[model samples]
Target: MMKRKILVLKYSFLAILLILLNTFNVNGQDEFVKKSFTTADPLYTNLLKATEGNFKNYPHSFLENGNIKYYQIDEWTGGFWPGSLWYMYEYTKEEKWKKAATAWTNSLESNQYNTKHHDIGFMMYCSYGNALKFDDNPKYKEILIQSAKSLTQRYSPVVGSIQSWNTRKSKGDINLWEYAVIMDNMMNLELLFYASKVTNDPVYKNIAINHAAKTMQNHLRADYSSYHVVNYDPKSGKVLHKQTLQGFSDESTWARGQAWGIYGFTTVYRETKDKRFLKTAVKMANFFLDHPNLPKDKIPYWDFNVGQPGFKPDWDFDPKRFKETPRDASAAAITSSALLELSTYVKGKQKQKFYNAALAMLKSLSSDTYLNTNNANPYYLLKHSTGNLPSNREIDVPLIYADYYFLEALTRYEKSK
Candidate 1:
């Protein structure tokens, strides 16, 4: 009798799983064909013009005719935005699109890729990650796996979190103590999680959970605002410094980092069923919703805590002493995509509001005046974008990721509607 009951229970769970998969059409014929910004919509057309516009400089990379080409956006090999045009290809299925994505993915196989940043999600997941998961393109899976391995190998048992940026003053010297964690690293957790899934080893999951927990403990303030970086001892996992590497948050909150925290925690909650992570996501998201300083445009300045209207920076707070914060469309686009995901976890009107806010941001982003309508510039985006202002790269243009997520949010909005 006991054996029979156990069998029944197992089958019942399997039946429910079948039902959910059927309901969501998880294996349906339709792939998540990426959407394009370049409809009759001026936003997309203008972006193409802007990014492709300048005769001397174009942020171009791709494999074509059995060769790869990369142009210098500047001193930095900056603006590697394959993820942006990947979706454009999804919509059009043009040979050029495939060639472009293929070239970018192939180049890394021969070169030492940038492995030590929180932006693996922005770099790989948005491009190769999606390509493998949705399209079953085995071509990119090896690279994605290599990418995950690269990120995971950076993990230090002493710090108990993934090493984010490499701080090597010399070549071949591994004494790099400079460690920091950014909210953007949260999306990269998927890389580790995938590694765990494929290897059937639990180590990756544990590392992901631990990294997230540490971020919550060390990087966040009481009101759910966040700092951009937490420096730590790699040997002992000690907090060495909490600095705002990006925005206002050595003591103030970066709007983009806050958005990343909210979105990333929500993702962790989805994976682990951790109540604390879910609650933290809610807390930070609500803080964002409640801020009165957001412009009529839902898009935010790169740092919300800076330059509140009618309020002067304290004498100690000098805007001129530091670089003025930029308005980051890329950050806004990532935040909106996160909110769409968060809606899946809430109920009724509570869910509706989060859903609406995300939609509002999309509407504002793809607007005619805000979009990059200049045919001279081949990038297909509009307002509030900055790439490598520190390096004076693409000072204000429609970033590739901005275009990617803006398209993603619009597609998600289309589905929810």
Candidate 2:
């Protein structure tokens, strides 16, 4: 009789512990969602004040002199501000945010035909993509299809990848790169994949698949760390140079580039349901999460190999100043958002691991260390993002895309709960 009583007591205690753990998880998610919107409300309002209610120019980042920098509709970052507004609208279902998002998104309509670069995905999809999610506007679909068509103009059958940049001289190199396909190009595949799904045309999806396969073949190192830029021979379709335009060195992995790879590959897997892309994404994510240089808070330095021996760039800045290196909250935001989606695709321990990592990133980003609560940079949300360290531009500043993905991660986290 005593033994039976003890067993019952032990089972009751275990059940109560499980209930407490579940409640704690739910409360934690609720806290993050509440804090995220509370901070975003003021930051976006300040952006409106700074811009004087003008939706023509998109907020990019703060300049070194502490002025808010604005980009034209054609700039690569043009979509993020509108995308963020759409996220706000989605979360609150407020007509004011919807109106604001529509106004900002309308400013980029001309970008539908922009074929000068491969960032049309970032420019058009991010803005219109989120807009279509909330409102079933036929015009949005039309614009997105046209944008996808324009993006295909950069795709080369020879290289089996979209050209990121036209013929241009890389920094510190005298030879002009005939064709460059960057890790960032992987992100643009989503627009193509979407186009394929909406229109039921295999052409767009085929291009995206070819690009992903080629990128997997050449852009990733053996350990899944990605190269920032891979220059190719336009005529021969041969890889001429595998280099870094934004990392600490040609051999070092740039944090944002790696984040792009993880997010991009995960997206491809989602669109195609191909196991190869999923495998690649898992490997790349593990590389990032397991890297030795990642900070305790999960925010990464601009480059993974910063201050590591023999990983110096030809730029003027000293690589030995890794301790003083700027942390990229943008990378953290992007990775957190991607990890949320990735967690849904996996099961068991991997799912828990990815979800926990995303939660940690959100916790750190929402903390005082990264969140901009003082309105010091009225136009941006999160701080400490490094845009381009080699050129010494926008280092340790609040970037617009950082806020976009941070809000996205928050919304995803709330939904997962």
Give per-model TM-scores: 0.74, 0.94
Tell me the deviation in Å of residue 310 in model 1. Answer: 13
RMSD of 2: 2.3
Residue 39 in candidate 1 has what lDDT?
Answer: 39
lDDT of 1 by residue, 1-417 (tens): 999999999999999999988867633312222212553135434434444533233343222242222353221222234555565555566766665555554444422255545555445666666455336766566566666766777677788788777664311222343776666677778766776776777887888899899888988889888877777877678887775545543576677678878878987898888989988887888777777756667777666767665433222445564363567777777778888988888889868878878867776676654555444243345445765333344445555556666766666655664
Segments in model 2 whose C-alpha atoms lie over 4 Å from true places = 1-21, 319-323
Worst 10 residues of 2 by lDDT: 314-323
Model 2, range 135-223, lDDT digits (tens) per residue?
Answer: 89999999999999999999999999999998989878756788999998888999999999899999999999999999999999999
Estimate candidate 1's alpha-carbon lDDT, on a 0 to 1 scale.
0.63
Stretches of model 1 off by over 4 angstroms after superposition: 1-36, 39-80, 92-96, 111-118, 168-177, 308-326, 374-376, 387-395
Give the Å error, residue 256, model 2: 0.5
The candidate that wins on TM-score is: 2
Once model 2 is optimally superposed onto the true structure by TM-score, how far is the C-alpha of residue 129 displaced, in angstroms? 0.7
lDDT of 1 at 44: 38
